[model samples]
Target: MIVAPGACRRLKPPYPYGSISISFGETLFNIRTDNFILGLTFLAPLAILFLNILLVFKVRRILFERKMNSSKKQRKSHISLTLTTLAIMIQHLASGAKTVIGIVRPELVPYALIIRHRLIDLGMISVPWIFYISHPMFHEKTARVSSFT
Candidate 1:
């Protein structure tokens, strides 16, 4: 079921009287209700940030090891890829942190929302350019067509 953000603030007990009571012979136990969404909301962004960091390191290592043998054109492509990846990672981290902080602290919602929206817009615009610049075939075809013209 879909749960609203406000619904998480006020919790209702599983039972009718707004309290859960358990009895085993003469023993009695009571437990407080917790919002699962709040926990998941906080954890999701952290998980994404961790995965992004791992990806950054792997890409950096691969780029470093391959740099020595690559030609000028290949080196340029690698450098473009490296810069694009770093930019994307920074955007991801900023957005993730904004989300986590916005959820945990409502006071920062407006600022976080603005930052997140701008980051998303920036990514949308830059991704196509990154793909165009990184594709080796695109450059080769352009050069061939340009020579004919």
Candidate 2:
């Protein structure tokens, strides 16, 4: 019976967040939270970006190596992989940029958060488009005509 596992919830956890302070003569921004969420949020995307850079470099080496024959299919595959990386990277950048802008210039956060959401959504929407076109199940299977009607 795995109905309720409140085994760890009974213990009181200590707050881990440290105050974020930015000051120009006087303090412009000073906020503190119980959880150190912002650090992870920022670092997670950064890690993805680092991985993306490595992937791109590896793909580039495969494409441009002296002895390797770079065919149309390989180029197309590389392009698709690069495009996917770019879409994901841009999405992460947009997400992180919003936070940085909010911290530096609180007045200029694009008014409504919907604008930021849309920018992020655009990147997310583009990543799947490549998959939709390339996936075999999604493509129509043409019947080979043995006898002409």
Candidate 3:
């Protein structure tokens, strides 16, 4: 028989787990659909992206410092360094794109619905990263203005 979504234990038929133990929606220890663990799994990529963003910030700081005191040739080198950091940041964002597709295309794979829910949960978990993504944009504008000064 096909089961409905979010069916309670009442409808669950017995399954063999040593003996007949029919586990259903949202159990203790939660071998079935542990949202917390699922959420952490989803945040794994965001955490990596956050680390990448941190590395980008570190690179940006170094470039900014060098731009302040370096010769023209040295300043040109900082541009290449900045470009590399930007490339890494773009790669991180591309990973996020994969996550977004998983969220958006839940119909393509029903099992992925849980993962998609977890990804949506990441919005709460990724609050810190929101600022991380913004910082570089703001820094780039500031760096440009300072260069002209």
Candidate 4:
């Protein structure tokens, strides 16, 4: 899950620099040096995305079914959660596509690498926003504090 540099490199002489080193479980996949492993790395995220889509659809259906009987705040929370989930799923797919493209198409690696960190930052920032909007308590506290001001 943790993709960091200098984690592990199995190349005979090791990669020169700026290589994609992904650590999953006990194995380290060095994409720049290993073509076969690079191609295989694509499967993990694709599989995850497939599973996520199915789960998201099921969750959305359940949320919608209970929407009619839920209070306004509950409805808002459900909507926020659904939207956040979809946004995250899309982010995951985009990241996976970028990784695959970077590995398969060497020419595009420069471009893909440039946006990688930005995408990660976006994902990190969105997590708190999702929690804030989806939690009723946060909204209530904000509303109360705003009323005092």
Per-model RMSD to reference: 10.5, 12.0, 14.9, 8.0
Q: The CA-based lDDT of model 4 is what?
A: 0.65
- Tens digit per residue, CA lDDT, model 4, 64-133: 8988887878777766766676656655666787877876786676566557657767777886788776
lDDT of 2 by residue, 10-44 (tens): 21212134423222221224433313666766677
TM-score of each: 0.56, 0.61, 0.37, 0.60
lDDT of each: 0.61, 0.63, 0.52, 0.65
Q: Which residue pairs overlap in candidate 2's backbone?
A: none
Query: Which stretch of 10 consecutive residues in model 2 shows the poorest summed lDDT?
Result: 6-15
Off by over 4 Å in 1: 1-41, 141-149
Candidate 3: stretches off by over 4 Å? 1-41, 108-149
| Candidate topping lDDT | 4
Candidate 1 vs. truth: CA RMSD? 10.5
Give the worst 10-residue stretch by lDDT in candidate 1: 2-11
Off by over 4 Å in 2: 1-35, 66-70, 110-112, 134-143
Better of 2 and 4 by lDDT: 4
List candidate 4 segments past 4 Å from native. 1-40, 141-149
Candidate 3 — which pairs collide? none
